[model samples]
Target: MSFVVAVDGPSGSGKSSTARGVADRLGFAYLDTGAMYRAVTWALLQRGVDTADAAAVAATVGEVRIDSGTDPLAPTIAADGIDVAGPIRSDEVVRHVSPVSAVPQVRTRLVDLQRRVIVGTDAPGIVVEGRDIGTVVATDAPLKVFLVADPQARAERRAAEEGGSDTAATAASLQRRDRIDSTRAASPLAKADDAVEIDSTHLSLDEVIGRIVSLVEERR
Candidate 1:
């Protein structure tokens, strides 16, 4: 049986880096569920669909094929056979992903895909990270971590990730995304009651990864 680890958190909370690190340390498969949503958003934009229109998004979501490679060292995502690891991170997709992800049909479809990936992992386990992983995607995961960081810290981290983008604007955009994601009608961003909450504001990436890795060891 795969020992699943569900890492849930808001944007820039270090869920991606921490989860990937944990997976690498343990030789586990890793899945970034957020990228699946971003891939869908990128597909919608490419198809000229208005992502803000719920109906349009729902109607068109199934037509997009999203593939997520699980290798921790070189994870990749593709939308309709097109490599989108880079495109999904573009500013346009980031701006529109929350809305596209809020569509019930979109969540329903992607959550099913995410579960399949988790269950089919050839490794002994998988570390899956996203807003809803602990609560919705893998409630039965052996270890659930809800990562958090102060808004300012998150903004700085995101700015660094974006190659020194304006921190103020990034902070504003993160806040906007937080409001949308937490209020979305579908699987909203929230901490699962049983999750271990880690405040990453002052924690080094190595420290965070080490903590989660220790938890996984304990659980095993």
Candidate 2:
């Protein structure tokens, strides 16, 4: 049986990295849903749409197309035929993505697209990570994991990974993202009731991956 894993977590949590690592070890496809939202947000920003206007924001959903690879090691995304693989993760997109993603129309479009990717892919299964994967997009996924960490540890980890910012600012940024993501109207960041919550604050990356592997094997 194909094993789809739904991983959901708040900003600065180790969801992205841990999901990618788990996918690599299990030979499963990795779906970065956050990048998709960021890419769409970037497209709307490029077009000069007012960030606060829901109708305006939703109008551009058709113009932006997100394409990602199934490979765990290689991640990619594009917006409006433009290769935004790198820029989507920039500070600009990061700041506004929550507002854009919060729009009802925007979420509707992206969620449909995400479902297509998960169902259409040839990979045996996909490990999807985002704010609402377990709650919305892949609710029926057999393996659901909600990764979390202390706010301080999350900030430190984010700061260390980001090459362009100081730890203090990175911490502040993550705090802002957490507020935005959790407060958004559409499929806000939440842990599923059945999801296994893992506190990765003090755990090593290997430890996290091993735990997920154990979960997967048990399911198998």
Candidate 3:
């Protein structure tokens, strides 16, 4: 039986890390759906499309081709055939990604692609991490996890990852993003009713990974 694990969380909640670790431990494919959205945002900026103009941003969906690598050890993302794993992490993309992802048309396109990736993978299964994985992308996933941390902890983690960024600003930005993402019309960030929610504020990355791995084992 294919064991699908859907992990959903906001920024800095350790979704990417935990999902990758779980996938690696279980020898499953890892799909980072957020990277796909970031690729689209990066593509929009590269093409000079007005992000605020929802119509304009949606119009570029056909022109942008996002390719995501699901390897747990070396996940990669590309936008329009250009390597964008690094560029999409820029502050500029961070500031605009929520708006770009909120476009209903963009979500429709990427969600379809994400579903395809999950269905087409040859691995035993896949660990898919995203804001709406449990809620939208993989509602039928056998193992669903929703991770959360306090705002301060999330900010500190994000700052650490960004190489000494300002924690206060990062916290504010995270809050703004949470509001935008939670309230968006299309596939808004949400925890699935059946998802197991984990508060990771005080947990180590390995601990979180272990917990999810254990859950997968029990399900198996």
Candidate 4:
């Protein structure tokens, strides 16, 4: 029996980190659903597929093969056997991911792959983190969490993670992604009606992890 925790949130929110912690604490496999999409976007760019061309995306997509480990520090993302660990996070790839992720065809393909990965093993459960895990891909998950923080705080978190990238530039890019993600018609980043919403602006990392762990422990 698979028990999945679907964590959805905007960029720079604590979803990814928090989910990884929960997964580690509970011996659940963690899935970075966003990276899967980013890898696809990076692959399409390498093939020169037009981001705006749905048909082109559909055609070249079968060439992409991706996998992610539950260990957040060692999380590996590859396309066609190539470790795209570097290119997947390049500015170009990040810029195009929202649009690529917006395509219904792209979501359908990636979502299927994600489900397969989550259920492929005999593991007890999974901690899945993404923009729409709760509302779209893993709506039936036993625990659904929606993480949100002040936009400025989110931007600051992203800037620090960039490791010397100009704060203003990275923040601008993040803002653009947020707008695109929020406005997209297909399974946009949103809080599901039944999800537990957590405002993480002031919470320490350990604090957030502890709270989610308690929530799961109490429920299970």
TM-scores for all candidates? 0.99, 0.95, 0.98, 0.94
Question: What is candidate 4's lDDT per residue for 1-220, written digit by digit as tens?
Answer: 5788888998989787888888888877888989899999998998899988877887777777777766644577788778888888787888888888888878888889888877784668788999888998888888898998887788888878777677678678878888889999887988988899989999988888888888888777
Tell me how far the alpha carbon of residue 184 in candidate 2 is from the true structure, in angstroms, after superposition.
Answer: 2.0
Top candidate (lDDT): 1
What tens digits encode model 2's per-residue C-alpha lDDT throughout 1-220? 4688888887778888888999999889999998898888888888898877888887767877778776789877777778898888788888788789889888888889988889987877789989888899988889899999998888888877777368788888888888888888788888899999999999999999999989998987
**lDDT at 186, model 2:** 81
Error of 4 at 182 (Å): 1.5
- The backbone clash count of each candidate, in order, is 0, 0, 0, 0
Candidate 3, position 60, lDDT: 88
lDDT of 1 by residue, 1-220 (tens): 7999999989989989998999999999999999999999999999999998999999999899999999999999999999999988899999899889889999999999999999898999899999999889999998999999999999999999999999999999999999999998899999999999999999999999999999999999
Candidate 3 lDDT over residue span 28-110, tens digit each? 99999999998999999989999999999988877899899989999999998999989999989988999999999999999
Rank the models by lDDT, top first.
1, 3, 2, 4
Candidate 4 scores a C-alpha RMSD against the true structure in Å of: 1.5
RMSD of each: 0.6, 1.3, 0.8, 1.5
Q: What is the lDDT, from 0 to 100, of the residue 204 in candidate 2?
A: 94
Q: List where candidate 2 sits over 4 angstroms from the true fold.
A: none
lDDT of model 1 at position 170: 96
